[model samples]
Target: MVDILMATYNGEKYISEQLESIIGQDFKDWKLFIRDDGSKDNTIHIIDNYMKKFPDKIELIDNYNRNLGVKLNFGELMKRSKNQYCMFSDQDDVWLPNKISITLNKMKELEKVYDNKKPMLVHTDLKVVNQDLKLLNKSFFKYANIDPKRNTLNKLLVKNTVTGCTMMINSKLRKVISEIPKECVMHDHWIALVASICGGIGFIDIPTILYRQHGNNQVGANSNSLLKKLIKHAKDFRYRFYTEQAEILYRSYSNFLNSKDSRIVKEFIQLRRYNCIKKRYVIMKNNYFTNVMLNRIQMFLCC
Candidate 1:
């Protein structure tokens, strides 16, 4: 059996659709646990109405008025789930009927392959959507090369490739993730980081969920237009520079390494020095930049 953990905060507009998607799933052995983080709208009303309709399948927990950010809310959900396998759900995303079954099967396969080792988390590709549930594009995870090894602290430092809405973490992972340092990044990123540390991380390349992108989206969805891309870059730069949030994530990972093994901590310290701001300048100083610029100019002039 699986427990679906969903956190909500004033998501009345799309909650019903997302709930319907889950309720319509072909998999029968699952329960949906929704924790409302003090929504000032009819979101809680909608959830309560659904729970009354399907008392056995759906349950709602009133989280009062605590504005626990996304990471904390998700952490709370994980801490409360009472199942062997837990899947994270966003308030507005619509999952495919096979989403749970496919992810659960993959986790089962990985368990068999890894043998005595603990199971790692499994996440699938997502189909990006708009507020009205119109499909924009699929999140093709081809841009970054995913390392298959268990220890991927080095690889994860480059980017967070896993999307939370499509994530299904094992119970073992859920038990230990709460111990992650408070300075860590988003929950999904932290999950990926820990999964890389504990056991093998698996990915389902096909899209199994509709990752809705709305106006109130905390983290902007991936964009393709040049202007939107630049705007997103600017926003990220502002966040990273002003809050130094990425550094918090780095240090938490560093702490995790220190607790795991001293050698990894030392290596992480060295990498922080080499791969920090100075590393970008050092790479640009090499002849690679000159050759790239010359090639770009030649191509542009010919065009």
Candidate 2:
């Protein structure tokens, strides 16, 4: 059985569609753990309505507590789950009918091939969608062809190459995530980083979910324009460096004990992160350095 962990706050407009999508999954042996992170709107009301209709399929937990961010929300859910398998859920995204079945099959395949002691985390590519659920010609499955054994810090440095909403991680990985440094970025990235270190990640090229992008996006919209990315990089430094992303990656490099090729790539990333923290003037002075700094800042904040 699968437990779908979702955190919602003022997501009334889209929560129902997402909930319906999960409810309609071809894989029926799953439950939805709905937790509202202090929603000011009818997000709770809408969920309450749905829970009334399908009490067996959904469980609502909305005891208003402190406004814990996404990382803590996820960590809290992991602590509460007793299932052997758990999947990350976003408040506004709709999963395809076979999402659970496909990911579960992949995890079982990995389990057969690798040591049982190896912590398992499997993720699939996702199709991007708008608030209205219109499909966009993009995916989070770019790393589908990557060799799990060859996964390295350097590959992770060039790009995150991981999508959180589409991930399914085993409960055994819970301890590793619980112990991750709080400064590490989003839960998805943190999980990906930990997976890279402990066992390895299994990737699926199939698009399993409609990853919705909305106005109050915690990770913002997924746009493909290079010019737009360049512009946003300069504007969102706080979203980048101060977040868990920078620290998690830094820790990954610091803890990496693998191939020299990957280690060297991570070293550059770590050095660059270190330089930025020290407020390296060399990066600020050079035009190209400024661009790199801006890009780093953007990634740190968004991840």
Best by TM-score: 1
TM-score of 2: 0.75
**Alpha-carbon error at 97 in model 2, in Å?**
0.5
lDDT of 2 by residue, 1-303 (tens): 898888787888888888989989998998888777777888988998999999987888655564777777776677666788889898888889999999999999998887566788898877767678776545634312222333344444334556778889887776666644557556776777667766779988788998776676524434677667556654644423432364455555455445653444344444444544443332232211222444555544432
In lDDT terms, how accurate is model 2?
0.68
TM-score of every prediction relative to native: 0.76, 0.75
Error of 1 at 185 (Å): 1.8
Query: Local error of candidate 2 at 194, Å?
Result: 0.3
Q: How many residue pairs clash in each candidate?
A: 0, 6
- Model 2 Cα shift for residue 14 (angstroms): 0.7
lDDT tens digits, residue span 158-231, model 1? 34667788888887777656554455567787788777665557887778998787786624435667566444
Q: Report the poorest 10 consecutive residues by lDDT, candidate 2.
A: 282-291
